[model samples]
Structures are given as structure tokens and as C-alpha cells.
Target: MFLDNEDKISIDRVVEELENRPELQHVYLHKLFKRDHHKGQRYHEKQISLYAEYDRPNLLPFLRDSTHCPLEKALEICQQRNFVEETVYLPSRMGNSHSALKMIMEELQDVDKAIEFAKEQDDGELWEDLILYSIDKPPFITGLLNNIGTHVDPILLIHRIKEGMEIPNLRDSLVKILQDYNLQILLREGCKKILVADSLSLLKKMHRTQMKGVLVDEENICESCLSPILPSDASKSFSVVVFHCRHMFHRECLPVSNTVSSVQFCNICSAKHRGPGSAVLEMKK
Candidate 1:
């Protein structure tokens, strides 16, 4: 039900019913109202006190005063209804998960409102339910990220991991959400390291021209046939070697063949090398 658009329920009647309803006596409406903003609109404290005393069949007129409440605070009231009623938990009252999900999907016609609602759910189960409902709906994620981008905010998916929840999958789902928004770079750099059997040499060549190649750390020895020295230990050959064009690489790590005929770019920087036979590897120190 789009409360703002279609649900014509009067606020006053609801408040009246709430006052007479024994289930709501323990619900401290005052605490919630105190924490929220009412803007510049004046509200009489006396009115609330008197209104609370009314046990009438209809009080829509008094409740209609909520129209003056700020949008965020008004939203909180609607969400509180979900918890107050608790009828949603009854399969007969609100249907099973599938039916409830379908109903939420229909109600989420307003992306902004839906996202606001999503943020209010501190429970992981509710978040999972919302995500499952949104799986087929692309707007859910798109709208969520767009809201974050616009507001420069982050989604508080789960306040904290709770017992009985699939912890690993929850973390992975969060990662997927970050990646989908192209925001994974927010994570640590070490985690992004590319690992491959031959990645070291390939990276050396690729970055040659783009940077001043200098291998600071070298480890392990090649189990392959060891000539004068092992290829894996190449990084330990020289402290540093400067190329003719001023490019540099670890002397030990230099390719045994020193083949550069097809290599047109420096290993560190992408500097174009048109010089004869590529610069010779000369010692820097």
C-alpha cells in the first residue's frame, strides 16, 4: 500500500484506535516524538495529553496533525506499526515468506521510500528478506547505490553479526554489493594483489616503461635446473642496476636471456625505447 498515494487512512482514527487498544498502552509514543524533529510547526503538549485520554471510536481529526511531521519522523511511525501489529509474523495474517515478499515488492514502488525503509531494518533476517525480494528487481540495488552516491553515505546492512545467521555468506554478500557499485577499491590494497604462476615477470615487463623498476623484496629459490644461479633468485643478483636509458631492475631478477627484441616498452614505465638494441643493463651502484 502506497500510504502517501493510495492509502487514504486518516491518521487521527489510527491514533484513536491506538490509544484504546490495550496492546499499545505500553508503547511510549512520547519517547519517539521527543527524539524526532517537528520543524517550526507548533504542537501542543496539552493536546497530546488530552488526546491520549480519548477512548473514542474515531479520532482521525486529531491524528491528522501528523501531516505536519517531518518526512523522516513520519516514516518511523509507519515502520513502528509493523512491529506493533506483529500480525505480519502469522502466516495466515500476512502469508508466508513468498507472499510477504511479493507484497513488499508491490509496496516498494517508491524507490526512495523503500530505501528509507530498508535502512531502518536492523535485523539481518529482514535485510536478507529485502535482498531476496530485490533479486529480480534491478532498481533495488541501483536505487540504493545511487542514493548512497548522492548522499555520500554507506549502507548499514547489518548492525552486527547475530547468532544462527550464515556469517560467511553474509560477508560475501556485502562484498558483492560493494563490487557491484564499483566501490571495492575502498578495501585494502594488499587484498587486490594479482597472483599468478608467472605474474612476477609479466608484471615486471608491463611496468618497465611506466615506472622505475626496482625489486625491493626477493625470496625462495627455483627448483628447476640451476645454471650458475637459479632464475627465482635473480632478484638478489644486484642491489640495483641502471639501464642505458636510465630504467632500472633488480640485477638478480633480470631475465636470463636478457631478450628485449620484441619488448618495446620499459618494464617499470611505458617509455618508448627506439634506441639501438635497447639500453644495456649496467650496474647502478
Candidate 2:
């Protein structure tokens, strides 16, 4: 069959090509072959017969692109550390194809395989974002909350929506989580945003190389009054306002008198400052 670069290949064209070229029969058979890894034998001959019905070359692109459901299942299985079940049951366009064969040869770990699957399926961005949320990274978690300041409220809302937990207790628990870790379970679909000031502070802190202790050791610094804050569960998820002068205080920690005018008394140094509040999201734990 004479093929043109611009011609769209359909199932009819694929059938014509396969019938005309005897060599393609081997390629078709190779694509459908399923080997039993443990016993070193092939699966039932029916598996190939079943696959042959839908083996149109033109359908491969669509099948590969429409892999979100299996991708999600694979992610869940990977997170649960069930690689065998995932590899065996998870469906994809390139099932045991040359690319999958290469991946199998590499003998990659589950997470690595997930990453490769994401790349191969062209869903790397989505899977990567999900992995970031699923994996608990303290700094990334804290940084996320510091940006949006939406964790406490949104988490409480989600819990309420789920309706499987006590509202009051869950609200309190979420508040505490927000306060200690600034842990943000990302609710946004595809994009992440955080406060510029908070991000810069985190960046500066991360670049510091002269630390004398463990990186995540919590230092008790009071948000309000800039005083040496004590560890308190009640103080969790409370928003703070930091000044350009490095002065900081809890938005709620400040006296109600401060709201009457732009100038507010600093609880720590008792200094008067003027400017809009610079919201500080705290990550205590």
C-alpha cells in the first residue's frame, strides 16, 4: 500500500496495510503476545484473540491519550505500594508494548514507573501535582499554606462536605494542623499560588547553610508581640501580620484597639507602626 505523509490512517487503511504486507503479521502477533513472568509461558491464546478485535493502529493515539482513569488507579496502587497488582490490572494503550517492555527491562521502582507512565501518557503535569500533594513534604506543605491562607477554612469545608467526621472536632483539628505545619492540602485543580512575601521568606530560609541543628526543629517565636512564643495547641492556624521592620504579631493576637487606626501598638517592642497588614501564615510543627 502506498502511504502519503498527510493521509489520515483509519482502521480500513490499517487492515489493508496488514493484509498486503506479510511481515506486519509478525508485528501484530508480537503486540498481542502476553508472557507469564513466573512460569515462563504465554497467557491463554484467547487473550491475543480478544486483543485482535480492537488492534486498529489508528486507535492507539486515542487510547493512549484517554488514560486518566487507569492513571488514577495506578497512582492509588503505587501509593499503597502494590506494584504487582497495578502492573497486572492497570489498563493502558501501550500494555506490554515495546515501550512497556523497555520499562520492564529497566526494572524501575513503583514511583519511578509512575513517573515514567506519566511521561509516556503525556499526563506528567497532573500526576506530578498529585504526587506533590500526596507526599507529605513539610516545607512544601508549609509554603503552600503561607501562600493561599486558605487551608484552615477549605479543609474544614471539605470535611463538612464529606460528613463522616464531627464538625466541631474536625474544625479544631484542621485549625491546629494549619497552625503547626501550615500544611495545605491543595484544593485548587491545576494551579498553585502563595503570598510573595511568605515565599521569599521560605526561599531565604532554605538557602541558609549554617544551621546548627536539625532543619525542622520548631523554634518558639510568638507571632504577636514578637515575644518568645510558647508551644500551644490553641495557637494553631492563627494568622499573623509581619512588618517590613521584622516586627510580627497574630492578627487576632493584636489588641482590638489597633483596628481603630492604621497605627497599631506592637505587643513585643510596644512600637507604633503604620501600613497595611502583611498576613503571615504560621507553620509551627
Candidate 3:
């Protein structure tokens, strides 16, 4: 019971007959559009409106097959329906509309556009991907570092370079980044060395003073034991060792071995003691 050229029924009556049969609807509509141009435009518009109202799933295919359906109208309907995935395929049906193509590219994760968008938006995660992608390309990394150095985490960047050390192509770039990073560390260490040297010089001067002598109430005190070295203590005189620095200490207090060496320097001033090897001293009154 198909409608044909021989049928005397009006197009409205034929369409009404096919309304209940979805399988035959497309066939009848396609034939009607091919046969009667005026009626076809009316039927196409009516189908577009009905699809927009109740058949969003079939809207794209309907629009694609209909001669009178506008691409802009399809895009609008997709937007209204929030059909993001469907929009991706709309460009092919619409002969590569630029906006549709861009939407599809973005949805498909176009690397170049992703990087560009990330840079524009200052997105760290996307920049990280771009950085990893440029690992083997030194020139690109140099440019990337120069451009985004302030925005990126330098510590993370350093860590990335360290991990890239095994890559032969990345070696030069890694070295350059490391050199700049280490230069600051070296300068900091250099300053620490200078401070240490200054402290050591001050400590040496104080040590020299301690070795020279300690005067207590017009009396000389032994530096090691802080005891008075009285000239009147003749009995204990043999128990003392005086260094060339003019400091005296009990022989037991001084770090000396049973074997006398050719020269023994004061532990404090580090100066060699000058005199007889083991001569008994006679103090002047």
C-alpha cells in the first residue's frame, strides 16, 4: 500500500497515512521531496520543527538528509540540546564549518591547540605536558623556559631536568639549566667559606693571647689549669714546662710523650719552645 504517482490523494493525505509508519516515513518523504519541490520544502520544514521538539537524537541525521535543512539551524539545535559529542560530527555534515571544526579539534584533544590554550589560560597541567613533549628538543625547551620560567616551579623544572639526564639529546639543555641553578649555590657556599676563614683568624688571635700568658692580680696563671704560677713555688718548679710563647703549665698537664722530639711547639700558639732540652730553671728574684 505505497503511495505512487497514480494515487489521486493530496500530499497532506499521503503524509498523514505514512505518519504512523516510521519505517515507511523516510522513504515516502524522500520520494515526495524528489517529485514535488514545493511540497518537499514544506515537509522538510515540518520535519525539522518536529525533530527539534521531540526527536533530538534523530535531528542531525534528519537535517543531513533534508535538502531544505540549514546547517546553522542544526548547530543551534545541537547547542540547545547540549549535544557536545554530536557537535564533533557536525562539521563533516556541514562541509567543514570552521567553528564546528575547532569544536571537534578541541574535543579530540588537539595538541597544538591545547598548548596554545594552556599558554593563553596559564594552565600548569597543560604546560607540563608541553614541557614533557619538548624534552628531546633543546631549542624548544630553551624557548619554553624563557617564556614560562616565572610561571613554572623552578624546583620541579630542575627535577625534570635531572630525570632527563639519561637522554643524550637533552644533555646539553639539562647541563645549561643545572649550571645556572648551581651557580647560585656555589656563590652561597663561597660566602660561607669567607665567613669561616674570618672566624678562624679571630680564633687564632685569641689562642695566641691565651698562650702568651694569663695575668691574675699581678700573678701569672697557668692557661691549662687556671692555677697561679708563683715564682716562690720553688718545690713545684721542676713540675712545670714553659713554652717559647712565655706560657707555663704543669708537666703533667702538657701533652708530652716520654720520648722527647727534636722540637715541641706550644699546643696553643703552635710555636717551637726554645731552650735546653731538660734544664732546671733558676728564677730571678
Candidate 4:
């Protein structure tokens, strides 16, 4: 019989057509499952059970889409078919998907998996939820703090716990968790201080190098007036100023400034000028 391509086709007629052809039963049922989860699931559980082993993979998608399918049931299917990672909506609508996966991992008593999921999410609120839920379980708390405490901000969680204080029974355990958090913070600050000190030391060394003066060489000449500074005329009335780069210029030929020390830069290379004599000049000022 030819089927009309009409939108008004009843679900009963569609099912009857698939019933006449057993080969198309799973495919049509899956389509119906996608359309109406409640009825489709009922048919899937009853009629689809015959081809379940061969058609399980096809059935998983329908189960994943079915609102009637409980998270526990979906998880069981995932475990049986090893499709946990493949099913994106395995958590259902109870909570955030990642948080729900974390809960599932926790239920399975897979602490590492739950911690890894929590870290991947990088949500402070989710981490806090995991912390609050696992508080009474000392072993789980220890593992969480050891693995992820440094990666997340414990201060926020601590503040939350302090505000509520509902779980006063676990106060000592909470205090221990805070101690680990404080230790992590202290180590981080210590590292920053060390980095700052090293940076300052390196900067001081660079400054000293930039300010150190060198003796004038044969090629050294005054840049301002293009005059040669002769070593034989060193004792002459014309005073010479040797810059950090060995570029020499007559003091009178230097840039017009208040004092020699005030002339903080070279007239030749523009390098900063400094020496024992520059300090003496500053003292004279």
C-alpha cells in the first residue's frame, strides 16, 4: 500500500504500517520515540526488545532523547554499551550537565573522575557543591583537597561554610581543609616575593651598567662641535667630560645645563653619564 506524504498521518496508522514490515519497525519506532517519548518508550521496551542486541546503539539515542528515561537508566545503558562519554545529555535535567556527571561519578565512588570533572568545569559554585557534599567523607575530602584545592579558590568555599556553619559537626574537618588552603596561598605569595626580588636585583645590575663610565678611546670625539679630544691636552684649561660609552666632549662644549652632574646624558651617544667624578660634581653642587 502506498502511504500518503501528509502531516495528518495518525501515530496508530504509522505503527500499523511498521507492524506489517518488521524490518522497518525499529526505524519507525525510533522516529516515533523522537516525536512522543512516553508512548515510544513503551513500544521500545515491549516490541523493540526482540532486536535489542543488534539495535541497542539505535535505541540509545532514543533513550537519550526520551524525557521519561531516568538518569539512572540512561547511565546503566551507557555503562552496558560503554557510551558514557558519547552521551552528552546523560545528566538529564536535574542539574548542570557537568555537575550531574560529577554526581554520577561520585555515586560510582570514582573520586578521581569526579575531581577531574569538577576541575574541567572550573566553576567555583560547582566545586563548592562538591566540597559541601563530600565534607562528611574524610577520604573523599582529603583526595579533593590534595588534587584540586590549589587549583580552585578555597577562600570562597571557606567563606560559604563560615556563613552557614550548618555542618558544625564537621568543624574540625573543615578547619583542616582551611589549613591546607592557607598553606597553598602562603606558597604562592612566597613565590611571587621571590620573583619580585630577583627582578629588582636584575634591574639594579642593568642600571649600574648603564651609568658606569669608560675611558675615552682614540676614535672618541666631541659630537656637539665635532672637535677632537686629545689625551695630551687632558691637563689643559679646557676640561673634558668622558661619557659612559667613551665619547668625550669639552665641558664647555657640552649641552647648556645648570651643572656637570645636571648633564645626566652624553652629548655623543646619548648614554647616561656617570662616574666617581660625576658624584664629586654632584657633591660640589
Candidate 5:
């Protein structure tokens, strides 16, 4: 007596039903994907096989999301079926980006798409490959020229252009590139001015705040020592430091630092410096 797994029989039956009724493949496939998401490798293999044999429009998108599908097997079927987009996407997803980019350049002959794919990947080698492919085609050359100063440099593409070839909208593309460069320079200058002005304005505001006197009367008490900041006797006088947060401490009650420029953190109000607010240094006398 022998026992066998049920998944194989179930998947085989589902595949046959899907193959026999092409109209309901997507619905059943969606159900299979959702209900049996973790139905193991057997489930994914069935999906891959169905996608390769039939031109189910929604097949690749499902395959794209499933990591269980064998990429090499899927690509082979997609290529045979003339599924150009799938072939390109599958190779790229499999890390064979050079092959995918080649198909986009030679097989698809779509200059804009090839450039956009290169930009999205943001690979220098891909840009070089695109530039080399575009060199011989005047229309491709024109398309790349329009993207200069943004996705690519004009010098790189311009020197590659054939001497006798006439590119479409050549003068207009150059003008646009120059305008883009000028606009970028102006933007940088404006940003610099705004940043500097903001810095100066903040500094001036901080100076004014520092100049404003704090009311240190007999009612005031030291936050650190928890004693009267000003003694009732008129003959004696002591120093104190007052923070912008209005926390006061006696000069001798706070910790002493060896570094002259070390930050003085208030023991009370310190929302920025983290820690449990170490004792503040003597800032006022």
C-alpha cells in the first residue's frame, strides 16, 4: 500500500481545466494565486507552464509578483510567443539587464523607452550602451539630445553623432539644453541666497533674545541647589545662570567643565540635547 500527496493531482486537474477553457483562466488563476499562495513549487510551476503556452494578457503580471516561478523557463516561453515586453522585463528582473536593454534598442527600436529604462535603472554602463545604440540612428540621436543636461550630458552624445547625419530639431534641442543649464544655475543661486538670509535672520533673532534681561528677584530660586537665588542680607552677593527656558541655578551649584566651548545643558529644560539634562555651566554673573 502507498500514499501520495494531493497537491499534484489537484494542480494537474486545475491546469487541464484552465487549458480546456481559456475564457475562465484569469478568474481561476486569480483564485489559485490568492487561496493557494503558499501551495509550494508545484503550484508556481503550473502557473509558469500555463503562462508560456497561452497568451493570457494578465499572466506576466502575476508571474512578475510570484518569486516561486522559474525565470529561465518563463523567459523561454515568453520569447517563443513573441511576448516582447515580457522577455525584456524578465531578463532585467533576472539581473541580465544588458540583454534586456539590447532587446529594447535593437528588437523594439523604441529610443524613448530605451532611454527611460536606462534612466530608471540609473546605471552608467546602461547609459553608455544606449548612447552607442543611438549613435547610428538620427531620430534616436535627436531623442537623446532633448534629454541633455537632465538624464545625460550633451558632450557625450554630440561627439558620437555621425558627421553627415541630420538630426531632427537639432537647433531646438541645443537651445533647450542651454536653457535648462541656465535655469539650474539660477535655481542654485536663489537657494544659496535664501539659505544665507535665513541663517543671518536667525542669528539676529538669537542675539536679541540673549540681550533681553531676565527678572531675577527675591522670589527666584535655584533649580539645581533648590535654595534662594538672592539672599535676604544686603551685604552678600552671589552669581547665577538663567536659561532661555527660565531655569536658574547658582554658579557654584552647576558642574565645572575643562573645555571653554563645551555646551552648558540646563538640568531642567533640555528637549534637544537628550540625556537627563546634566547641570548647566555658569553663563551669567
Candidate 6:
């Protein structure tokens, strides 16, 4: 009769009876939720509170499956009951993961869980808080030391460990930290060696290319003055500069600048003829 929605009297009577049994209220609510989900939304907050009030085992499951329950109110209810799991979960679900982690460390006292939570959040502030919470607590310190080497600086924890504290497996933790440092050093050395080898290979290639030099004959003309770079006299004393782009210049034809920090240009090159080659030369003596 209570299953039939049309039988308001029977449902009302059963609801009144179940009200006297707070433990069974959530069960009835879950039944109503199963029968008609849209209708169940109206009772969602009530069901959540009932589960929290009775400290029901299926509180988490109920929360996971239900919607329309105000999370803030539920968080308040769970906190008042000191329901560690729900309190932590509610805050985390609301994006307050730090508060959840705080509860996990302070109330649950599970170092592994706290570390994993911090890792999942991957926030710097959260990791720092975790380290701060673990300080002076030997077991927590040991747990953090065993882990977090690759993810965080071990020195942050090592230097902060209390002077008189005792940590089990402290030797193992130290060895792991040393091994991590040695591995990092080896990786850096390997990268440096690779870079040096690459540089040497590039230098050798450049040397081979330089050996096959530019051909200079009498026909080459100066870009600045449009005059032949090499005169017909084979024994003439002359100085010429040949660029990689094959533009040639007689030493005396190009104008020189004495200013310490100014661009080198040629009024003749611009006025006479120019090439596509481009460069900025800075000379300091």
C-alpha cells in the first residue's frame, strides 16, 4: 500500500511510523528514491541529514548516488557529527581540498593517505602544509621521507626534522635521498656530454665546408664603389674583404666609422649597388 503513490493515507501512516524510527528513515527515503527519482529529489536533503544523524554505514553511498542535497548543509551536518570521511569528502567535493587534507592528517592520522591526497591535488601550498603538519611527528616524517623525493625537495624535510626525534628506517630514507641526488647528477653529466659531442660534430662539418673556399677572380666588383675588387696587376699590394654572400669590397673603398657604439653603414653601398646579404657587426677594441 505504501508503494502505491495514489494511496496518500497509507503512505502518510507509514511515514509517521518511520519518523519514530530514525534509523529506518533513510531506508524508506532510499525506497522512495528508487521508486521515483524526480519525486525523490524533494526528500534528498532530508535523507542526507537522516543518514548523517544516525551515522549510517551507507552515508557515502547515499551521497554518491543522490543529488539536490545542499552540500554546504551536508558538510555542516557531517562536521557536527565528527564524521571524518564525510567531512573530508564534502570539503574536497566543494573544492576545499586543503581543509579535507587537514582533517585527514589531524583526525585520521594516516600519513600515506595525506601524502597521496597532496599528490593528487599537486598544489605547492598543499604540499607545504603537509610537510608542516608532518614535522616533529616521527612516523609522519618517516613516511614523507620515504616518499616525495622526486616530487619535492627532500632537503626541505631533512633540514626541518626535529633535533631529538627518532625515525624508523631513517637510514633507508637517507640512502634513497642520496641515490636520487646521484641519479640527477648522472643525468646532467650525460646531457652535457651529448651537447659537447654535438658541438664537436657541428665544428667538424663547418671546417669541411670552409675548406671548399670561395673562388675570387678579376671579374668580382666592389659593392660600395662598383669597381673591380682585383686589379690586373698580379703583384699589386691590395686588401679586399669577401663576404659569404660573394659581395666583395676593397679595404679603402668602404667608409670607416670611429664612433664606439654606432651602426656601420655605407652611403656608397646604398647609393651605388647592394646585395641581399645582411648582418649587424659590433666591434670593440
lDDT of 3 by residue, 142-257 (tens): 55544453456555554566443444345554555567667768888999999999999998886566455433232776667877655455554445566545666655666764
Extract clashing residue pairs from model 4. none
- The per-model lDDT (C-alpha) reads 0.41, 0.40, 0.57, 0.58, 0.73, 0.74
Model 2, 97: alpha-carbon shift in Å?
A: 99
lDDT leaderboard ranking: 6, 5, 4, 3, 1, 2
lDDT of 1 by residue, 1-285 (tens): 212322474434444556666334313333233334242134333233333344222122334444353333322343454422122212212225443333455643555554454454334454555555554445564554444332223354333223454443444455656664565454434354644535887867755753554332333221122222223454554334444445555545556544354443445555555433334433433
Better of 1 and 5 by TM-score: 5
Candidate 3 achieves a global lDDT of 0.57
The candidate that achieves the highest lDDT relative to the unseen native structure: 6
lDDT of model 3 at residue 189? 99
Our model 1 lands, by Cα RMSD against the true structure, at 20.0
What are the models' TM-scores?
0.22, 0.18, 0.29, 0.41, 0.65, 0.52
Tens digits of per-residue lDDT for model 2 on 5-62? 2157543455446665534643443343322122211222322222223443422332
Model 3 — which ten-residue stretch has the worst lDDT?
A: 276-285
Give the top-scoring candidate (TM-score).
5
Clash pairs for candidate 6: none
Which ranking of candidates, highest TM-score first? 5, 6, 4, 3, 1, 2
Over 4 Å off in model 3, which ranges? 16-39, 49-61, 89-96, 108-285
Clashes of each: 25, 9, 0, 0, 0, 0
Model 4 global lDDT (CA atoms, 0 to 1): 0.58
lDDT of 4 by residue, 95-182 (tens): 5656465645555676676777677767777677777777666556556655665677655444543444344335565566778778
Candidate 5 pairs with clashing backbones = none
lDDT of 4 at 2: 16
Total backbone clashes of candidate 5, pairs 3 or more residues apart or in separate chains: 0
